[model samples]
Target: MIQKSFCAIFLFVLGLGPISLTAQSLEIDADLRARFEYRHGFNNLFPDNADPAAFVNQRSRLNFNYTTEKLQLFIAVQDVSIWGDTRQILAVDGNDSFSLFEAWGQIQMNENWYMKLGRQVLTYDDERIFGGLDWAMQGRFHDAALLKYRKDGFMMDLGGAYSQETDRNDGNDFRIQGFFTYKALQYAYLKKSWEKSSASFLFLNTGFQDFDVNDVADGVSYRHTTGTYFKFPIKIINVTGSLYYQFGKANATTDLAAYQMSLEATYKKNKVLYGLGLELLSGTDQDGAAKNNSFFPLYGTNHKFNGFMDYFYVGNHANTVGLNDFYAKMVFTTGEKSTVLVKGHYFTANAALTGDADAYLGTEMDLVYTQALMKNVNLNVGYSHMFASESMSLIKGGRPHDNTNNWGWIQLIINPNIFKADLGTPSN
Candidate 1:
């Protein structure tokens, strides 16, 4: 019953353990991750005999935090699996991946305002378009309501959301099926900082739930996005930029315009770190164009963009043809907690490609290595390769040039903190 009333209001607020009204505090944390993979062509393309998909996935978390002086709270609980897919004597958990990733609260109404609400995490700024995907182990949330504003360096937020699937008595059909479900959402964010430069802006709106073809519920289809992000510095190079635009209606009969743009530059010396970038998304062609120019970066963290063996958009490119990444990277530091990263990409095809095919799609290489193994642990390793073409095997299928497209991985992370308290302040 609602997860037993959220575990009895989380053990009655963790047994009301640390409180003093104006100086309260409490914390507990944990997060464990595990990963291992060995797919042959990771997110697509590698067919000839097939049989290369090893596994081992995990992610477990527990977090609770609380504060006072106008309240603030958080809660998280997670579990994600895949090792042997359960079954070591289970009663019921054959794979629903336990969850409740976040539960929020924030109240502090004067002095710059605040009023967050439940199930949060809507990262902004360079996240392209809201993100907190946290490398996917079931890490994305938003059951919104916000109204925050900060001071000095400037900040602002105003959000909203509404979705339905239960507690019904009327109608507002949001029969949650997914692949990006949304029946309402609104957003606005703003940022400004200086001392080195910064800027941000966003305005989003989503709402989709229009069916009919005997599926009933027909009404709701709004899509709109607007964006901006930029950072500055130049004497030693460190620049960033982004621009976005998407118009309304991507459902209930298409009609959506799209766009995305990007720019990047980096420079660091002493331990190396150099980069370059380019990006553009806006597509629709392969001849089915009715009205829907593809440019979906919807909820960011698309595997941190373009390459990582995730072949486009992470959930399979929507509305096709879009993209034109061009990149370069470097990181090297290899010691005192190690580091290394090497990257490259050069894909193309931002429209038109289905007649004699070939808009040059292919080329990727990525390598990663990181180590820290202490103070909360960490380790990661990676590999990737993909050099297809023939138009990426004519839009991602197989063969065409498949020299065993590649991918490999390993990861481990642990975050610990397990408890803290301090109810200081309040004497006579």
Candidate 2:
């Protein structure tokens, strides 16, 4: 019923056509991605008593978009299925459900003002520090409304949203956020000379309960995050840096404060690209007694982080164990239709330890080949290897230990420009 109401409202608005008949536009686009993987030693990362077959899973995503002069909308639906004898582990019941990833509308009031409301993504500057966190099998979203103003190189935004625990519940948890951005400077480096430097600030306040009903009874929790990023070109290298600080209260008991920083340098020339990155995070333990000096990736895409195996910062676990990651990657194109990419990751634990203990250490390597099968169809094959350290394997109790694991994946991406209607078509 809610979905139907939303669609009806959307179509009604879309039916309004363009605000200005002289200057109107329409566009439709979509992206479809699928992944197949094979695993070895994958069970090493899970509990020892757990079945190895449970680690293998295949996934796919279908993303669609439609836009006009005054409004824009997008949706991404995902599906995951198990292959071979791993069927039971990947249950196909309620667990397999379609989701509304991004369903939003944009109202462009004028050249310098607009508003977007609904389930949408909010990404700013370099996603390295503040992003939509879109790397997971299912990305993240907030039921929110956003107002934006833009002119020249300056932009400002205000947003708010609510999430209810019950269908007919009266008390609905909510969140509010505000952001501002400005391009401080823009210049040329050498040769063609192209450069852009900008700064952004974001403030978010949220009050919500945990997934389990028993977690927070009455009190509301909140988290405050502030971040900034700077980017420019020096010689042939592009440099970027990011920093973030978060403080809040969760469960009405524990007080939380954390921060993270990252630095990156990239060099691109011709069809070759190479880059290096470093990231650090600081947080606290569940007891709020010991300080956990880990890495908080925020909304950045984790797959684009330290390693492809995605052991740390996968969620909040890295918040427990301190993490120090050094990453590097290179991409090169072949002919006009094929491309090759290579990435390497090195990770080590930075947690404050009492005794002489080996921190977790790991390395990952990825190789990818891409071929443009057609104008809107592309095929990619990828393989990744993860080598774990002693700290990742050893176990203290009878439970299975965290060990090194190896996994590989193959994917296909289809992006088609399905339709393009004149901006004034509706107005006419």
Candidate 3:
């Protein structure tokens, strides 16, 4: 399988080399990353008699980019897998983790306007509302159409998408099970940048397929999120903040009302950078109103916001008692090629806990060291420890909080450019 993967990369370069030489420009690149992790209690409290889990996962990708005077095309293919998931001498890959990450094209309408369509990524300011979730192995992509405008320091983007189970002509029901996705989506983003500051606004609407009690598709339930993000410098400290509100129906029968707010400040002194931040996500009480009040980050990179241990909002914690996170961070530049980062997070429930339990969830500490091994190559090592309170155990299925909870990981990332060329212009 490894040899076959290499052969595929080789063939891609060979097949596109001649055609690229006659076009305006073409570039090919590859991204490879492998990570090993040891988790005793990674995302939850450690069970008393459970053993630790350890594994290695990898992501391999190849990207091709072609550019002309008025058009740009990009395609990315990726494979994500866990080591030893497939048999050594197998003829077929049982894991079946290969996929198309992105394939999109943009056509220039004029000097400052363009249209982009196909499977692409939407990453906006601070990524609090809409983001390209790159921390996960599969990342995130959308099949959508976009109208973009950029001029001076102002930018605006309008995007929309509709999803279906297949090309069936009979019905419009999206019945693919086990995957949580939107049936229809629309969003608008606007931004303005100054010399030292920037501000952006986003309005997003998402529609989910609503089903009746008989397991039949009934209609679509819609949710709306609107927010603004700002970043500016205050003397020696840099400040960043975001405010967002969510409304509309959560499903066929539930009404939604939620909000999220965050603020952070950072300053650099000598070889160290110090930072502090707070994030508040509204939540529904244990026995509160019937409406859904829990806030969800939707498509954003939740890992980047919460603790790295993924205690909240990685895959779970949605529609639950939301989060209140207070964090502090410090980064030390040890040398020209290496750096160390240490961060601490204190967590609590935004709503009342069951049985009048304590609201304090726990505290977590994360340490990471990164070294530049070579050009386009880097090494990262990290360790995290969670000090869980009794409240945490209550929320995590009554697991004992006295068990030691920690996690460790190491990763290597390599991104290499394979080819680049510019062939003056296209011939008519």
TM-score winner among the candidates? 3
Task: Using lDDT as the measure, name the better of candidate 1 and candidate 2.
Answer: 1
lDDT of 3 by residue, 179-287 (tens): 3489999999999999999999999999999889898899999999999999999999999999999999978899999999999999999999999999999988866
Cα deviation at 422, candidate 1, in Å, is: 4.3
Once fitted onto the true fold, the runs of candidate 3 whose alpha carbons sit more than 4 angstroms away are 1-23, 177-179
| lDDT for model 3 | 0.88
Lowest lDDT sum, 10 consecutive residues, model 1, at 1-10
After the best TM-score superposition of candidate 3, give how far the Cα of residue 415 lies from its true spot, in angstroms.
Answer: 0.4
Q: Pick the candidate with the highest lDDT.
A: 3
Deviating ranges (above 4 Å) for candidate 1: 1-20, 28-66, 73-105, 110-129, 136-223, 226-245, 248-282, 286-292, 304-308, 314-352, 356-389, 393-400, 422-428
> What's the candidate order when arranged by decreasing TM-score?
3, 2, 1
TM-score of 3: 0.95
- How does each model score on lDDT? 0.84, 0.59, 0.88
In candidate 1, what are the lDDT values of residues 329-350, reduced to their tens digit? 9999989998999999999999
Better of 1 and 3 by lDDT: 3
Error of 1 at 342 (Å): 29
For each candidate in turn, the TM-score is: 0.35, 0.76, 0.95
